[model samples]
Target: MQKRILGVVGSPRKNGNTDILVSRVLAGASSVGALIKLIRLGDLDITECDGCHVCWQGEHCAKKDDMEELYREIIQSDGIVLGTPVYWYGPTALMKGFIDRLVFFNSPLHRGLIRGKSLMVVIPFEETDMNTVKPVIDFFDRCFTFLEMKLVEKLVVPGVSRKGEVVTKSEKWLREAFESGQKLGSGLT
Candidate 1:
């Protein structure tokens, strides 16, 4: 069976660096026969997590929103590619909200739905210092670690601010992103 990869773009700017990078990764995955789907959080109606904790009791979240569909997609996907531009040394507000909603999977009843899935993260930042992206890396490391998900790859591009920079000026990083996707896609099979 072909592996399914979900590409979630957390950047609000469509066709921006994050979006392009995420698409490159998905394109790479597609080249290897992996089924890929892209989801732009900016286009969705994902609300902030209400902290109700109802999902902890094996019940669905109290708030009805697009997250319900996201849960289903996540459950069906064999791998995920999460791409976001850095905002205030962390993920964008859109990505953060999506991450918050992922708490539903923390429930023991739903943990199995996410454990062992492959994950690839793409982070593009405007800062020139490599250390500047550490917080973003650390944040994802903790979350995926706690969830028992295998982090297959990470493409962190620093010093990029303007749109299309990844494609225009960062050929090396773009190649790395594609290779990361190839590696991730091939590994699943």
Candidate 2:
């Protein structure tokens, strides 16, 4: 069966560094014949989790919005690439909100549904120091741990603040991102 990989972009900026990297990863995955889908959180009208606990009772969220569609896509996907720009030493608000809605899957009633899936995190930061991206990495690590997903890889690009800067500063990183996607698509990571 062909593997289905989903790329979720959390950056509000369209075609920004995060989006570009995620697109490159998906392109790599496509090269290896894996089916790919890219979803931009900024385009969706996802609301914050209201702590309604409805998912625990019904095995699904009660809110009627774009998240419902995302939930289905995530459940069907064999692998996921989460791309986000670092904001204030953490994931952007869009990323956090999307993750918060993932709480539905964390309920005991729905545990293990997403287990064994592969996950890759792509973070682009403006800071020259790599340490600035640590918190974002750690956040994803903990999240994948809880979801029982395999963290296949993490691609961090630093010192990219301006638009389209990634294309200029480091073509090497872009190549690496593509390679990582190929690995993920081939199930080698």
Candidate 3:
């Protein structure tokens, strides 16, 4: 069976710069024969993870929202990609909320189901400098590590301000993302 890659566009803006960049990465993964699925957060009714801790008991979130299905999709995936826009030096509010919901996968009971998953992060920010991007990537790394996931690559596209700048042109950072996806999708490493 082919390895599955789940690309989650955490930005609420559909097809925004971050979305397009992640799409390119997932497209490259598809080119390599990986099963790829791209989900736009804006279209989902994912609620913030309240302190309910309901999912810890192996129960779905009590909110009965789209997040349950999203989590199920992620549990079935082999590779994961997170796409987010930097706002005030961090992931967008929507992305943070989504990440918060991932707490369920951190528990030991689910580690067997979620461990060894490959992970990537795509950050689209107005700052193009690597130094400026490091913190954002660090945050993503922490999130992935918390789930015991293996993070292989990250794509931080800087100096992109407009919402749809990615569709008009590709950035050098995209090469790394595409290649990362190709390598992960190949499922050899």
Candidate 4:
């Protein structure tokens, strides 16, 4: 069976910079014969974590929602590409909530599911300053480290504010994103 790559778009605007970059990455992965699936969080009903430590005790999350299915996808994927736009110098709330619910994977019972899996992060920001995306990258860095996941690549596209600007304005970064996906796919094989 072909390896699976899951792309999660945390941008609120469909077909925006973040989504386009993610699609480019997934396209590259597909070119390498990897099965690719993209999920837009803006279209889902994922809720925030209630600060309940039940998952830490090897129990399930207290709430029932789209994340149950997302968890399954995450488990099935050989690689995951997380795409998000910067908001207030950090990842969007949608992305943050998704990350929050990832506490389920923190439990020793489920930690192994994520260990050694390939991860790619695609971040698109409006500001010209690269520092604008630092917090977002840092958060993912910390999370991936704690989860024992290998962060294969980070495609950060700065100075992109409008929808599809990344595509219209920068061929270099777009090529980089595709290359990162190729790397992720080839690495898995």
Candidate 5:
């Protein structure tokens, strides 16, 4: 079987809370023989999106950096699993920066290629009520919908406050995230 899943971890901290959850989900996905590549954006030499419209000229973003490599992977994968923590009720800077760079995809040049892909989101938060996460959740959901992609699973594990605390403590939710990854690895319905 060909490997078909790509996991992107958008945390500035390598061993941060979000990274652990991302690792666990990848591990579970690998257990089922899915090819998994975990890209930790924090280690890359990336830059912010300058809102350049170069993507309209071609199917690729003109902003040069490590993100160019990631863009290739995004197009190659059958599924995209994003593991990110919400900061200030939104996506962390690392992820927001990457998404902003993807502004090129919003151009008509690349419209047809990115459509109908599958995405899974895993989020760990410190909010007291999981409901507070609605803002960020809806943000991602709407983006994917606008891009014409399918949302396979969304796991929001709240109440994890300490550094590197979510994966070990969120046994139940982590398992659910793993199962969600497995489901995504099986391909779209």
Candidate 6:
């Protein structure tokens, strides 16, 4: 069977730089014969994880919301591409919430569900320096490691503030994102 890749856009702004980058990545993945699905978290009604520890008991989350569907998709996917815009030197609130909910996959009972899966992170920030996105990178690094997932790639595009600005100002970054997706789809990373 073909590999399935899921791209999750965590930016609240529709058609923002993060979303454009993710769309390009998914397009590249599709070009390489990988099945691609893009999920815009901003459009979903995913609630915050209640810290109930119900999933630790081998039971599903107590809340009924869009997260349940996302959990299913994540489990079924071979790889995941997470894209977010840097806000206050960190990932947006939507991204943070999504990451928090991922605890279910890391629960003791489902410990290995995410093992061996691949992950790619794309972050866009207004800061001109690449260092500005370091915190976000570090966050994902630790999270992915905890999940026993492979951190395949990290693409950080700097100096993009306005919507659609990346398209004109950061063509190279866009190409890099596409190439990273191609590599992931080809299983070369």
Compared with the true structure, the alpha-carbon lDDT of candidate 2 equals 0.93
lDDT of 1 by residue, 1-189 (tens): 687889999999999999999998888888898898999999999889889899998668877889898898999998899998889988999999999998998889889989999999999999889888999999999999988898877888988889888888758988887877777766652
Candidate 5: worst 10 consecutive residues by lDDT?
A: 180-189
Poorest lDDT segment (10 consecutive residues) of candidate 3 = 166-175
lDDT of 2 by residue, 101-171 (tens): 98998887776778889999999999989889999999999988988889989999999999879999989
What order do you get sorting by lDDT, best first? 2, 6, 4, 1, 3, 5
Could you tell me the TM-score of candidate 3? 0.91
Q: By TM-score, how accurate is candidate 4?
A: 0.95
Number of the candidate with higher TM-score, 2 or 4: 2
| Candidate 5 lDDT by residue in tens digits, 1-189 | 545778888878778777877777777777777888889888887798877787888767776789889888888887888888878888888888877776766788776666888888878888878767888789889888888888878878888867888756757977876777777666633
TM-score of 1: 0.96
lDDT of each: 0.88, 0.93, 0.81, 0.89, 0.79, 0.91
Clashing pairs in 2: none
| Number of colliding residue pairs in model 3 | 0
User: Pick by lDDT: which candidate is best?
Assistant: 2
TM-score of each: 0.96, 0.97, 0.91, 0.95, 0.92, 0.97
Candidate 6: clashing pairs of residues: none
Which 10 consecutive positions of candidate 1 have the poorest summed lDDT?
Answer: 180-189
lDDT of 1: 0.88
Which scores greater on TM-score, model 1 or model 5?
A: 1
Worst 10 residues of 2 by lDDT: 107-116
Candidate 5 lands at a TM-score of 0.92
lDDT of 6 by residue, 1-189 (tens): 588999999999999999999988888888899999999999999999989989998668877999989988998888899999999989999999999999898887776778889999999989888778999999999998989999989988888999989999957988998999998887777
Clashes of each: 0, 0, 0, 0, 0, 0
TM-score of predicted model 6?
0.97
